[model samples]
Target chain A: MSDHKILQYPKSPYLKTSYYEDTAIQAFDTPFRKKCLVIGLLFWVCFPFVASSYVVHIANLSAIAAIGAMSLNLLIGNTGLLSLGHAGFMGAGAFTTAIMTVQFGLPIWIVIPASGIVGALLGLIAGLPSFQLKGIYLGLSTLAIHHIIKYGCSEYQYYGGFGYGIVLEAPSLGPLLLAGKTVWFFVLWISAFATALLIANLLRSKPGRAWSAIRDRDIAAEVSGIDIGFYKILAFVVSSSLISMQGSLYAYYTAVVSVEEYSFGLTVSYLAMIIVGGLGSVLGSFLGALLITALPYALIILAGLVDLSFAVKEHFSVIQTGVFGMVVILFLLLEPLGLVEIWRRVRCYFELWPFSYKPLTIIKR
Target chain B: MLLASIVVLAGIYALLGSGFVIIYKASRILNFAHAEIVMLAGYLAVSLAVAIPFSAASLLAVLCFCFVLGMSIYAILIRPLAGYSVLSAIILTVAVGVLLNAVGVFVWRGEMEVIPFGWRTYFSLPGNIRLSSIEFATLGIVTLFYACMGLFYRFTKIGQQMRATAENPLLAAQRGISIYRISGIAWGIGFAAAGLAAFLLGINYAISLQIGNIAVAAFVVALIGGLDSLLGTIPAAFIIAATEQLTITYANPRLGDAIPFIIMLMVLMFKPWGLLGTKEELDRV
Candidate 1:
């Protein structure tokens, strides 16, 4: 059933592997994957000098979003559990890191990991209900967490009073000053890459396979002796930890925290990134993050081209909100698999070149 | 005064919550955009009052206009999207909300406006339980609406069809019921109730493009009451309102919004199903 004429390709003159040998069918177990990782690392090392300050800022935002998106992917894409309150978990991490650093004068290293630990603890607590519930009930359960975080941060006097004022000093790792755009860019990328690596490895492990099994068929997985509850909680914890790390990095980058920044809208945006990128792929996470993060800037530039009156410019947020909604709907209707899937198809086409033929059975049954 | 306020808030929430239950039961969709519908109706009411002279005639006109708006939304958006996944429906409703918000901004120019309703002396009980005439009217109207809805569901064939649809869409369809028609009716009723609630809210507070903020409060009320139980919504609404009032009166007023959320979390942790919802009903979701 999986066989197709499009699987064939003209032999590469320079390489031993024939196009007919099914390069696409080869499992992701080549030294090429390692070389790709090395190149990615080299690019990051050189990013500080090669990229402009503004590009570095954008990269930082994408990295932070990637971390959060990766966490969400574990729950939604892998475990088939929906979370509407991921921003809340991120907020928990951010606020924890911020409060510790600002109030107790904790070191940067201590605060960052502390943020992840706090996030993981909160994730586990929040995820407990999933052991007993499924579907919309579980979704609402997570939503309740979001509201709780929002309310707690806004009203609870321990963090800051309900006026929504919370601020933190940027951190410095001893002699290595980790503030400004340069340091933020590197820190966020490192965090994102670490998260991606962890997710990749987890996906290849037993727990990851269990999560997929649960996602595909929970009853079958449970009947097969897989502990559904354990894997669900594990996914939630790992996802939450990554989100918290992102949150900590965000807090340190901006040196401030506001309840408004972690609203349901941010959660929606994160969901959009994953959905638009390709739900289960690591490449999809980064692609969705970069595209979504850049979309608003592109809109702003486009809006600038039109000679709008000052009054209209002030109301630009309304326009932006409308555009955001339109974009989400368009993607939902036109490309639900997101950009990564599209990128994969394009790569496959180019790789096959002259011998490529339409795959007759590629359409979903 | 506090007691009177709680009763009035309870009555209003009961009306809205019952409407939410009816719709959810029939469609199996939570209708997240219900709040946006309420805002739309409120805006329409304001427009009617402005376009026509403010009289008893104008009030009737506003109500009728809102009813039509409610029916039209069902026919246009809700009916077509029926039978899709609950998540897709949710995303669609959210999209509809965003669209409505944009329209509201354009219509109101993002300004806060007061709905003109002539006032009389504030009513009071012997124990110094003062209540505004508007509040009293709202409570009375809410009671009337709930009674009518209860009678309709118990006695009317259309109401029975709606119930059947809610209970089992496939079975209802097999029984020769038009699920679309039932859902459309549910949507209309839901929106009308939300409209009435929004009117009462606007009478007490100024209306703005951000009227959906109140919907969040309503959502918490609905969740606490249990998504399936209309009877449970009244007490849940009162509890939520009282908590907010007390938090403002005694605790820090800034914590008022957080109070409901804290209560929701506590309820969810202990009884993942809600105050009135059965575990079996929740498991299906």
Candidate 2:
């Protein structure tokens, strides 16, 4: 308790809460939280200008993935539910948007929301079983959902005739063109920012607290009078919506929606992003997506610079996957909280400066 | 011929499904890397066979290599991550699988290799039933492996320890058992079984980087059989395999992969713990 209180500044009115209080640190008056918000906003504003075309592309991709990862974190990280089939929800959104735009000639505004709604509806249906199940059973249930979606999309002729997937034209906002890397960068960033803000605000609300409670200990949360069923479904709905949003964005960015793009491998990659990002942390999701997405491209460029053999270059894809695995394992073994936690530590170190002490007591404090 | 081929495929599924069940039972984590281990073993066997002068010698060498590889994986990966969150362990195993797949692709350059198992003969049976030499060998080897496992568990002291650990690891530890050692042996055995299955599969089909996609059937089989029940795996594997074969042969060839997944979904909806899995075992952790 003393250690928890040590970081609190007595002069700050925001620090008056007892250290044992279970409420999240929501008081924005605190210097740390304020600084973080300011820095984040500044970065968002200037990101497009400062970032190179390749960097912008990576950032856009990361932003979309971040939203998806954040959504998954809500279920897995917050609610303690493991879902192996999230790509199904993303696929639902992607395919829905793809179908609407290509087949039905729907406008982007109508299609995007419809895609999210479709995703939420499917998520609700998939998550309905969670009310009766727990743990691995729940995980397997989601996995089933994943396979069903994959097979349904691939084998069935309803969405698109066999062997042909839906493709969309580049979107435009009224007279303003929203195409290429530049438009996608802005679109994904705005969506990512909105998602982050929504999640951050939700964390401050009662429902979010309920979700966190359910995550830490569902029995205790149930005992505390939280409707376990409602919150659990809500988590799925919200998370699925975000994932679907990402899916819609992904479809537009790539302009093609193929079963190959939404394979189990991609699901694994998304999970890896969440793990490497830091499970429950919003910032961790962004960091993890950036690392996982960029690492391969960076490695490929390095390999090219060294004039690697054709065989080696061909194999580099697998090697990249291996390195991703190794990074994930190393992170789990060394810092389970992930890169976000490491970043926090680095920030704290700089903030504390020369006053940092290495003694057990000081370190713990 | 198709029916016979279906039976052989079912037999292959049973082999892999049993391995998955063993690992899941002894250590309550789905080894996402299980398929990768199979791929690794297949590649290893092919590489070793190519290097060796004598075929029998190469087969023996491959088996020994698989055993050692399995043991090392347990020691290096599973043991350290013991007691961590099941989710973390699952992800870690998946990561390891990715790593193995990467290494395999890096070494093999993503090429499909034709493994020559030195058997091309087919035996005819009643009602147009015909089985290839490799299929017969696979079925025989699988039956022998299961028989050996059943006898080993029934008769051996280490086997009893494994059962105890699987039943209740904490309680087994209280009874002077080294749970870590039991878990290691379980992983070692599980990996070796996967290796054997991969080798058999490679003999029938071409081995490549994408062999892991085929191994996804193991999950459906494992689920249908009850992740904890060895006996259930065989029947479930056969049923799923039969469904896949029938769908492919009659309905649509493209639906072959999708059929197992459909069965998996149906099973999960109706009996999530599986046919043989008890409520207590199913809900643990």
Candidate 3:
């Protein structure tokens, strides 16, 4: 039965593995998979060139969101460590960018990595408590970290005399002024693509396997000689650093760094992205980001179609939040495996075609 | 005066934390929506107080509504989440919190609204400290609530059943006790306690959407007292309230919001099970 299923698809060069060399180990193993990658890349490349500035802006936001979501997925989904301080780390990166560019006039090259380092240090501090705390306790500690970061950011804003927030000029690379939505769409999406590649590669490596082991059962993993503490802390550091870098990019993209923007609500939205997209999957992170980022606009369109009252339209933010909450709840309750599972099922249906049901062998009585 | 403030704040936290502790004791799930419940109760109390002529009647109405709300929340959201991971239940609570907050803002506009439970009177103490009538009332109510809870658990058949379920759900079910109903009652009592505290808080200070943040501080209180131990909530609340007061007085006022969390982190690091909680609880999670 399984053999029949395997023969349904065209034979691919990378389908079989040799003794020393694994062809199936590559990211795009199948020809169809390679084709999907090319098409996706083409679409991403063409998006900003063809779309309106508003649409491009939304895409750029999704790109930044994708980076954060992927980083969070690395922690929550892969490493089995829940973090509520994602926005705190993102805020750290944003503040780092704000101070570095606006105050010291630092180059973008130095600023981005500086933000990551800051996040890494914060991650270390946050991860230190994870040795003793697990499950809900760890999540609570992260929530504390988030509140502390928010408090610190506000105090820093006060001391700097930037009552509102610090603003930055458009970044420059020699003659290239990285300003408009179109430029940002490329910069952000490319960064997101780079992050996705990095994550994909990491997941296939030893550390990734160790992470999965720890996530599944820490005690069993520890008994097997895996350094659970080191890997857990490493997960925090890597994930936080990636998210922090994305935060720096976001600061640049928005041209402002305000403490108000990085709220617990923002963290919840990123969490929604990872969970809704498909936890532990690279492509799911991006898809979730795009969907969540566009959700509010979609709600607005729906509201217009429904001919909602002007007063109802005024409360669009409320409706958006309610819808977001409902979506997260529905996803948690009905589709715990998330959109990726649904996608897989759909793909399987098409691949199987007429024989959608499981294949059966002939039985002679 | 500082001590008086600590006492009052401790009373407030104890009331809030007891509800948190009760729900955790019965269900083995942390109710993140308790904060929303607090906010909603405050709003509901304010609206009810306005609609009803008598203040006491309004309070009763609000408490009854919150009790039913808690039971329905358990039935609709939590009961369905039983088969899922504990994390799912926690996240579902968060989602519920968000939904409640949105609905609240939509109805109440997120603005601060004071509960018009009449004018306050200040009472002078021997040490040149003066406290409001509401503070005294809050303290009295908190004491009464805990006392009632203790009595109820010791004597009432339903409370005994709840205690049995909390101790061992399978055994309780084998004994023909409805664990679901017991859990619902726990939620109801928990919500009612938080609601009463919220109403008292609204009477003293204006209640806004931001007031829900108090639930976080209350969580720290609950943790310090131990998650499942009701007796620990009082001292935990007292400790947290004093620390918060001292920190605000001595350190930067901005640290006031972060102090409870910092303490929470410390408690989490040094004692994952909480100060008064059972050691086995740490391993269970």
| Candidates 2 and 3 compared by TM-score, better number | 3
Q: How well does chain A score by TM in each candidate?
A: 0.86, 0.87, 0.92
lDDT of 1 by residue, A155-188 (tens): 5434455255467766788888787898788778
lDDT of 2 by residue, A153-226 (tens): 77544435735566678887678767878777778888887898888778668888898888878889999999
Weakest 10 consecutive residues of candidate 3 chain A by summed lDDT: A356-365
Ordered list by TM-score, greatest first:
3, 2, 1
| lDDT tens digits by residue: candidate 2, B142-228 | 999899889878889888898888888889999999977777777778877888888888888877877886688877899888888
Q: Residue B104 CA error for candidate 1 (Å)?
A: 2.3
RMSD of each: 4.6, 3.9, 4.0
TM-scores, each model vs. reference: 0.88, 0.92, 0.94
Candidate No. with top DockQ: 2
In terms of lDDT, the poorest run of 10 residues in model 2 chain A is: A356-365
Which prediction has more favorable DockQ, 2 or 3?
2
- Residue-level lDDT of model 3, residues A1-365, one tens digit each, is 99999889876653465733451345476677899989988997888889989888888899999999999999988988889889999999999999889889998989999999999999999898878777777888898898889898989998999988898999996688898898888888789989998888788788898999988888999999999999999999999999999999999999988999998889989988987888888888988998899999888778777877877878889999999999998998787777887787776677768875863332210
What C-alpha lDDT values do all the predictions have?
Answer: 0.76, 0.80, 0.87
lDDT of 2 at A138: 81
DockQ each: 0.50, 0.59, 0.57
